[model samples]
Target: MNAECGICYEEYDWKERIPCIGICGHTICDRCRISMTSKKCPHCVRPDAFKDKNVNKQLWDLIRFTQLVFRKHSFQEEEFSEDTKRCSHCSEPSNKLRVCYDCCIQNGLVHKYMQEAEQKEENIETVLQNIRDQALCGDCVIDGVHFQHKTEYVDSFIESYSRFLNNRN
Candidate 1:
């Protein structure tokens, strides 16, 4: 599936450039959906088809997952690039990169959504499990990451959820 809107070719985002599902089951970006003179499916040209349509959660999840993977890969590429010096952590050519897990926990780097979910008595794990079960398919490639197993899907959901929470916070 394409990560961009068919009409404008803009990449989908969790924010303003969200993916919406038309009545005809075609994906449209939020911008294109709002810009239309009539509620029509931009891809199929079905009239009055996208009126009151909602964001497609599955597509949104996939896009977010792809974005997270892309970010991780980009960081890795920068770390291991030929021009950079080798770092002790990964033995990759990076500039003294070290992640302090204790510092992160002490600094409360964990976003507020997790606390909010706990306060609201909502089972975040269950929600993530459900998303993992329904949102991704078997051995699908999104963005540039090849998700060959269910664990990748689970990790994607976790990363996406963390990003969403971080953005909200």
Candidate 2:
């Protein structure tokens, strides 16, 4: 039997589409499968609690191939990582924090965040110097586009430069 698109309900020829079965046995066309957004079948909402070794390996292969396919399509501008941490490297939620694994590898976001930790340890001399020069305190965490967008402490930072320094301490 031919498969159908689960989302658009369009007819799909088996030759033109691939088959993927979730644990619930809901078969979906691989070309339009919801697996990219989730491990559980979107229809069943099962936790997908466990997986055998074979399934795990297949999943990894799927992820890599999908990432590559997405890259080719320019939709791969952002990466899909299993890293659940908000910030992955920071505390940012993975849902809120998106990084293109391809770009990150090329541009070194992983290394950059690693270096950011050391940035907080800037000596008192540097901190004082920056503050004296009417600049962001050396230890200040006020970096990234979030500051300009008025996130969290950024509003308060705009209120008082001293507040930025005090918070870093």
User: Each candidate's root-mean-square deviation in Å?
Assistant: 18.4, 15.7
Return the top candidate by lDDT.
1
How does each model score on lDDT?
A: 0.55, 0.39
For each candidate, what TM-score against the reference? 0.41, 0.24
Misplaced by over 4 Å in model 2 are: 1-3, 49-169
User: Measured by TM-score, how close is model 1 to the native structure?
Assistant: 0.41
Local error of candidate 1 at residue 105 (angstroms): 12
Error of 2 at 1 (Å): 6.7
Q: List the residue pairs that clash in candidate 2.
A: 86-92, 86-93, 86-94, 87-91, 87-92
Question: What C-alpha lDDT does candidate 2 achieve relative to the native structure?
Answer: 0.39
Query: For model 1, where is the 10-residue window of minimal lDDT?
Result: 136-145
Look at candidate 1 and tell me the lDDT of residue 2.
44
Query: Tens digit of lDDT per residue, candidate 2, span 1-169?
Result: 2225575565433333444566675655555563355556667777552121112334335544654555432122235455432332223223333332233235432222333345454454454333222222212223543233322222232244334434555
Highest TM-score: which candidate?
A: 1
TM-score of 2: 0.24
